[model samples]
Target: MVLVTGIVYKQVKEQTCGISFHRDTLYDPIVISRIRPDGLFASSSLAVGMQVLTVNNVPVDDMTSSEALQLIKDTVGQVSIVAENRTIAVAEAVCVNAAPLVPESRQKRGFIILKQVEKSYSFHGPMTHDMVNLINNNLRQLKLVHGANMLQFSLNSSGHFYGATNNAAQRVHEEDFIVIILETMELLGWCLKVQYDRSPGGWQKELFVFHRMSE
Candidate 1:
């Protein structure tokens, strides 16, 4: 709803709170977003489904999403937020990718990271373990050496992953594509670490955390 309501939300430019949000219309103009454990959001104690009522103490009830987001972006240093009956302290991240890369063509050397600011994606598909394992196997055999590469994938209408590498030297492999894409992203600082967890139809959920690479 934040996107449709014409709210001026902050897209992470230099630093971020490690969150992705959507407006909740059922109550006062509150935002619904995930606060990761990376210590970037209002508090480490914040959980999913809690409504964000304010940012830096500005009333969000009358503001659009963009306005609220911009307010958060404008405030720097220590940020205090009141929500769900307690106040939380959020400190802006001090570190950046010191070796930030410049955008260039695939044939050129570059850097890549997967899954950007948001942590997860929700899609409806019968994606199976066999399919996932195949991708991993493919990634282990990749030979691209020119540019930095990251995973760029989306769920098509037919419930299949249409995947690609953003800046690799060679074209995407048709088989085991997901593994190849994710492995390339791992070459960068960003990648998925699949773990064992129970989900519907014998599929495991993916967990991602954001961190800056050590130089």
Candidate 2:
């Protein structure tokens, strides 16, 4: 996203061809990732075992290790990367066709939280920080307040970034992720948050949702 510190539509001979928008970063070569469940397009760049620590200007470093992990799980969308030199504009993020969960799904929905216990298959390029940008950017588009629980989501997200790892079998660490599922007993009309132990090399299970129940 292109960020102009000054007023909008102001003429800057330097950015002659560019027009300013709001204070937010704007994209030129807008990039989008693959679509995942919940109408979100997950980032193709995101890989499992990747640890993200920040989004845009938001720093997750100050957060507890557990808190940081949740942020990525909850967000969906892309980010804007402004070149230091202002030579170019790029929306480097995971783009999604994201929409709100359907009423049926929401009624059925709940939340889950996962912690990264291992950093097994780190990609050659793009660290968790890069993925953070993508995650944060995606969240911005959704207009959702993703705090520590940002990435704390359902089982659908597991395989998306998992297969990309070369050593998929050995990638995850012991107790790498704490899996929690929110299941809706349709007959009972109540949601159940089921906590499970995620084995080192296995993926999380299905539909049981993971959204937090509000106070």
Candidate 3:
């Protein structure tokens, strides 16, 4: 993982017990260097050496990384991301693979994670015990979503995860494709949104399914 430097930090304050309190602050924005091949991390057009200073043309200095990520999620079509200290804009692109898993039906259920920023995709078919173990094993190495029984994990190549859909996360296999899941306030980093056609059967009527990726 490539760490972008030049991050500035300061301190903030609070009041309690008729006294004032201050705490050191940490503000660092997450930028993508690559995308997870089979996960919600989709293909991006952002080139190497590009420093992201803003999202959708908004300067990021005053906003938190999460906030900047959300701004990216809300935009579409050649969304702008600036270089770290440069005044020029960088290129932005995204791509998704096909998925092997079929939409759930009968008693089966399906889940996905969406990037409110670029709306990129990664789809998963079924979660197995072994897959869960593998994801847990590499949790620390993973950029964004990691841990157990993840219904959905969203992150760009840069490794920023904002929220989860089901909250029950499952580990993903190297070949399994998965979808991006999300909503308005809880935009999952810098992807726009998950877009896919629906299957004819399975799943709850109120829910929608997208083909995130394929192995």
Candidate 4:
């Protein structure tokens, strides 16, 4: 569970919170389904897919969507919320034989962590297209594409944008972070901050944090 705190300010005199929620059923937790890039909740740590657990110290795990909405509406200025950061794990076998083979074992596993940020993505790489294709293909096999039309990845080394391409000499050592950008019709743009790592046994695992990007 994660604690997210932010002020709920009115934008353009509209009472809308600039955030939307969804509940599959009364038994299910309320999940953040959509968020505006410039909305009140956008500046906070909240992100899509996070399950809303409590609103202003009131637990809404078992409440209906209307009940949860009321709790949020009752707030005057600052709002405090507790949510769950759900992680999706992809098994190693899913991409054992993926293309652009490396010398090490191809066995790998990963987790997707959804979160939000803002950035531009016009950097060019000699092999950027190939890298994007490889990652998207893996995402498709995991059934996590979710309508994302394009994906671009680059290495973030000490705050600088470094393209993660298919060059044989280029290496992503342990503790390196990769910035992944996803574009779609619905959400427009999203960013995935990935930390690449390798286990002592040579197994690879990537931790992906998803973020909503502003234009």
Candidate 5:
């Protein structure tokens, strides 16, 4: 059976989700090879071997790697890219309908964190010191101390960008990211400072849910 995910709204200007793919065995399920700090659409739910079944509900199984790649690259504004595990059931392609998990922060910044994917983006380089400074500088300006607001600091692990939640257990090299963690403890829970990982090849997982737990 074909599964369909919900329609989400565009949160960030560029959904620069740090996810990249490859099909080692034809369209044998597009492999999630790299998820950098840039690809915000990628979440923990989107792991390494998840198979991409469709792009916006259109099956990509018949297309060439380049063609499928282009299709994924071309998606915009709340488009869904569905994927599932080959060894698993069709019911598990969570990426298919990325509507609900995706968050948008227009008007005023809400408590939710947004996933910004840039399909046509290019990596700046071995992430540089200047870049780290800039990232920290900009994130510092967010004034995340206002509310239960949060931002996920996407750090590069190996070649991929893993979220702050996942990087703790991996062999994460500090050289890949700015070495600083922002925290605040207030009557209104703890102050959690967040920043988007701009380095290419990073994945943005589901919106930060730490706020709920804090409450």
Candidate 6:
């Protein structure tokens, strides 16, 4: 799962290759979040979602994002990078299940069913107004919204809600599960869960779940 690539860039002009990195915690491996289209790594085998293992022959498995960036910045001439491809790791954790047909009445009641797939993630929770708004906003930003029933979204390795889309007809209710089909293997990170209290002086509680799908 380890991949090696070389990137040559002017150190004087570019402090670090046009790549953004993210890590969930200090012990977590630094993951490539985004790559600039004009950057040196764009044309290389390096890609987003890959974990950084070393930079310029220096081991970075235990380094923070800042430390890794600094190492890359101090390198001269051509910089060699070693990364770990997590596709296989993600594939091992995926569980296959049969697809279910959701009726219109069930959809209105916050029931959602996705197409059958070899790789997919299912999330169970109570869908609230705030959750709906968040999903709609993210989907709109990613431009994945097409109609009332179609929805698509993606999360980074750190479990950050990056993209999502869902129409008004489909609502999420308590104990309802939403299944998402994965186009590519991805490391499932912690996802945010929200629950609202319906009693007097109601309050909302937030929870985090690992290896779960986001709203």
Specify the highest-TM-score model's number.
6
lDDT of 1 by residue, 25-144 (tens): 334434433443442653444444444666666667776544565565555555444345222111111112323231222212222222222223322233333433444455545544
Candidate 2's TM-score reads: 0.20
Candidate 1 Cα outliers beyond 4 Å, as residue runs: 1-13, 85-159, 163-215
Please give, for residues 59-102, the per-residue lDDT of candidate 4 as tens digits: 88788655676566556665666777664222210111112332
The parts of candidate 2 lying over 4 Å away from their true place are 1-43, 64-179, 182-215
Sort every candidate by TM-score, greatest first. 6, 4, 1, 5, 3, 2
Worst 10 residues of 1 by lDDT: 87-96
lDDT (Cα, tens digit) per residue for candidate 6, span 124-163: 3333333344444433332121343334334447443233
User: Model 5, clash count?
Assistant: 27
Candidate 5 local lDDT, 1-215, one digit each (tens)? 43323233445433334455554345356644444543455444555446677766788887744456555445666656676654542122112311211122211122323233322111222332333343445434432222222233444544422333223211122212211221111111212223244434554232211121121
Best-performing candidate as measured by lDDT = 6
Model 3 residue-pair collision total: 44
Which parts of model 5 have CA positions greater than 4 angstroms off?
1-15, 25-27, 86-215
lDDT: which is higher, 5 or 6? Answer: 6
lDDT of 3 by residue, 11-84 (tens): 21110011000111224333332233222222334432234565545776666434554453334333445544
lDDT of 4: 0.42
Cα RMSD, model 4: 14.8
lDDT of 4 at 190: 27
Candidate 3: lDDT over CA atoms?
0.30
Better of 3 and 6 by lDDT: 6
Please give each candidate's TM-score: 0.37, 0.20, 0.26, 0.38, 0.34, 0.41
| Model 6 alpha-carbon miss at residue 35, Å | 0.9
